[model samples]
Target: MTAEIKKQKHVGRWVAVGIVGVIVLALLAAIGWYFVRVNPSVQQVETIETAFPEESLRPEAGEGDGQPVNVLLLGTDARGEGDSLLTDLGDRADTILVAHIPPDRESVQIMSIMRDSWVEIPGHGMAKVNSALAYGGVPLMVQVVEGIIDQRIDHVSIIDFAGFEGLTESMGGVTVNNDIAFSYHGYDYPQGEITIQGEEALIYVRARSPFSDGDYQRVHNQRAFLRGLMTQLMTRENLTNPNRMADILATISPHVATSDTFDLGTVASLGSQLAGIGNSNIQTFTMPTLGTGMEGSQSVVHVNWDGVEEIRAAFDEESMTTFEPPAER
Candidate 1:
């Protein structure tokens, strides 16, 4: 029954073992190759400027990883005509978004604040919310936002047009649903689905003059663009390809400036924590407002105090699941 049969069985087992070992080695090699290609570009993230507001002025943040985190993201136009972002920290920001991550990190929420919202800016008196940046740089901006939300912001970032271009280009462009067709800056943007990259991306987001609703429609467009951008970044194509991700981060890093504590490692960890999130997990909306009204000679957006209180409750509860932004007007 026999010696030959036993010898053949042993040979088969050895061959199977060899095949599994080879497969494991090949998988490890592939992972190492991917890491080598993308890691250098990730290091570029560390190069972005870090400008944190003074701790004395910042609202108190809850300690430990179990608490929620709020990050203030500002997009400025201070880099025009040979100017630089660092030299013009007091420039009025056109884009103001508060990015919130709940304790579980199951999803990301981006809330766009109207630029001309009439809000109390500490020592500056009642003025446009955007003026907080222009009146007192990052510190006052932080204070004003914290006052509005009544919650501590764990981090902040300021990006200019260059950064916007890099983000769109790095993703090879992003597609957003254009609700209104409008010609802007010599470029005609048709209504419907469109993909824009580089400078066109910035122009697309910045074009609000063509709309009747003005900043109201502009904020909606901004949220749409951001939703599209994040969806592209989270795609399997970019996430699985180290070279693609490297190219993206390399382009974006130079133009972005974040708070000191929110470095590349912290960002990467956030990415990891939210690795499985898909398009449905991301939320982008504008903060509720009472439409635009005149406050003396200047026009400004009126704050919906009731909605603000609702948001504060959501923040304290660490869940935006029930949060509802006001209908677009």
Candidate 2:
């Protein structure tokens, strides 16, 4: 081959390879954006104003604000119409948890409140705490929780059951230590470590009939399952793999709705702050309550007034690491 002809062929081959590389990079960028971009279903509320608003009691605002960040996590069974947003009306909150991330951001503490706990919902007479969601939506739920803990909630996330299943499956199922074996919906979950996904995971979190304590034991299981799930998700392999992370995010976003005050940037910032925390650093506790009793005709959990104060003090002082339950006290 002539030198000039060979040189021209070589130039053509290099141009073709460059075009292919650009195409591949563009495709990857598009996939990343699809997964990383915030979903519209995560509706932000302008302000999460509670019924009893005391400016003095609210946590300070600014970078390094020297106060623990509180997020109210609501797990609802409200299956809205297909593609419809979760509404406040006629829907009940099945799970209520307050996730506290201290200013140091070294750990996260989760306190689960029994849905059937009898409490005074602001503007409404004494009723089941979960009823607040049906009565006043996110605002009422926040108001009631704030009243109980005496802490300002910085953000709110409402997750449906579908999202829970999707998130668990996206992580290839989560393995939680099953302290007690139980059967639910014809599926037998033996004691010891168990890995569950999809419908089985839903059954695992929702089971309550087998235990004498009913919902109380179920809450404990939920916390164990959550800890296991977080441990799996925080692994370097999962976080660094864009495709895995995107699949997880896409599965979760549509099924979640956040307060208007919380945005994509806020979510990313919080994730960054909490990146160092591990499952061991995440402490989970059930809100202190006297055993279940009948209120009129319906069964409910009575709040232990003294124990409640101790729990509130721990949150107020940002000392949950050392905080003990009423039983321990």
The model with the greatest TM-score is 1
TM-scores, all candidates, are 0.82, 0.80
**Residue pairs with clashing backbones, model 2:** 44-259, 44-260, 45-259, 45-260
Clashes of 2: 4
Q: 229-308 in candidate 2: lDDT tens per residue?
A: 87787666765565676667778877777766567667656776666467778888788888889989999999887888
Which regions in candidate 1 have their CA more than 4 angstroms from the true location? Answer: 1-57, 80-83
- Model 1: per-residue Cα lDDT over 95-187, one tens digit each: 999988888777788889998889998887899998877777777788888888888877888787888888888777899988888998888
Task: Give the best candidate by lDDT.
Answer: 1
Q: Report the error of model 2 at residue 21, Å.
A: 22
lDDT at residue 66 of model 2 (Cα atoms): 70
Position 284, candidate 1: lDDT = 79
Q: How much lDDT does each candidate structure score?
A: 0.78, 0.76
**lDDT of model 2 at position 136:** 78
